[model samples]
Target chain A: MIRKIFVIFAIAGLIMMLLPLVVNFEYKDSLNELSSQYVRGSIDDLKSQNVVTSVIVSYRGLDTLGEVTVLFLATAGVGFLLKHKKNKNSLRKASELLQTSSSFLVALIILFGIYIFVHGHLTPGGGFQGGVIIASAFLLMILSDINLKFNHLILHLVESFSGAFYVVVGLIGLLLGIGFLNINIVPLGNFGQLFSAGAIPIVYSLIGLKVGAELTAILNTMGGEQ
Target chain B: MTLTIIIILGVIMIAAAFGAIYFNKLLAAIVSAGVISLLASVIYLVLGSPDVAMTEATIGSGLTTIIFLFALNKVRKENKK
Candidate 1:
């Protein structure tokens, strides 16, 4: 009986803790004019029609770079944590039917993913979206149990080149009159072209590559029977 | 009517969130958490925070769910021999 009372009191205390904020009736109009500046801007310059994309890929590009680096670091950290585990092949051999059919689908999906990345500025998808798609293709390779050995050195080379290039792109923006990640210095190109939006698309593609590579490496290292 | 529906949905969502947080089993926790994430996205849209809603849907729900599943696989492996 005492335990039941204690449970009831605890529930009441929890509700009391949540009461004030939930019951408040403050107007949100002031929040728009006052807080919009810090939260939303930069829709025009990058030729990115999506304001959120513009802010993330252009205005705050550096932060995204840092974020991707953190993902890379996480991949590395997870790899380290699993390093000492035993290693063997995780995927069993695919049946002949799946082996033949999946390759064509993989190619098509990869092409589609590229299409998504290239059109990011004009539409909704971008680096991260395409990157994950590309990673799935690599994952499919593993699932097929195809012993496709990747050149880790070349993989590292590409990763470093892309990472350095992203930084260089940011530094060049600082060098040129605009601040870091000043995406408008180069020509915006025609808004909807594959080659549009100056460095935005390039950076996005590079990000796609980096994310794809890191995720594949992490999956290979961690998911393999290790 | 729409507002009432939204409020009901929101209450259900918050309940799911707390349920997810309070669960002891790991896989149940992950699935409950996913339900909360999806519901949170809906709530974000209803509240007119579309940017935040999109972010919450994409990264918070999508990427985060995948990451959790991956981590859970690792945890499951650890719990085994």
Candidate 2:
């Protein structure tokens, strides 16, 4: 009797969870007014080929700023919670295969990450994706060499300056242009060119560097073991 | 059909989730959770959200799994002491 009751309750719970998807199962027929406006005006305003990048870095820029702040805070919180407490001698050496191959792979991974963020205006990828990729490369390096150390001072400098420069660019827009993060400071050379999007690439690169440094710092802190 | 494929993916995700909960070894459970996250990202890709799919795949499956493993290692080390 108890087993039957448990099975029935589980079935009922599953049905309840899935009921909303079944009820609201219809294809979207048209784009809403805000999205329609974004799609139509993004290229002209931002000179970015990728609509997603235009939306993220130009149109809804404030939201992206807030998101970057949240990530910074999360990294800081993790660092504080996992303060370096482990003995330095406790970390064992990595395997020979990992130690040898990571040196070759690390450069390629970092380069690929830079490429993804640098071409944010014209490509599918943007700052966050590239930043995480770079952090992953650093993670590989850290895993390979237990004795390796990143210069905390340099990481801090990079993170702070990039974040501050992102805001300074926004302030420049606010002072001399239409509004904050207007992207009209520099010439929008051409629609599809590498340097066409005035401030989009610049902003994304700053974001990428900031995020990469923050995440790498978090990894270093968490894996400190001392 | 797209719907059939989506249904199959959903079933697979559900199975992975259950496996994550029921796995005896903590490492196996963590890996099972990663599998569920990876499959969910695939579903996101199929649904035409490539951006979301990329974030989910890289963060959920890649960095998160590493972080969890590190945390687990720390905990096991503490337990040993």
Candidate topping TM-score: 2
Minimal lDDT window, size 10, model 1 chain B: B50-59
Interface RMSD of each: 3.6, 1.1
Flag regions of model 1 displaced more than 4 Å. A1-19, A25-44, A87-101, A144-151, A190-195, B1-25, B39-63, B75-80
Question: A123-208, model 2: which lDDT tens digit per residue?
Answer: 77889989999999999998998878788899999999999999999999999967998888889888999998889999999999
Cα error, candidate 1, residue A122 (Å): 1.9
Write model 1 residue lDDT over A1-226, tens digit each, in one string: 9999999999999999889878985766565662355344433445555555666787677789889999899888987887786535344577888677777778987887687677666666777777777766766665565466667797678777878888888888899978887776678876556676678887887887787778777767654543
Model 1: TM-score for chain B:
0.77
Model 2 scores a TM of 0.91
Task: Name model 2 segments beyond 4 Å from true.
Answer: A1-18
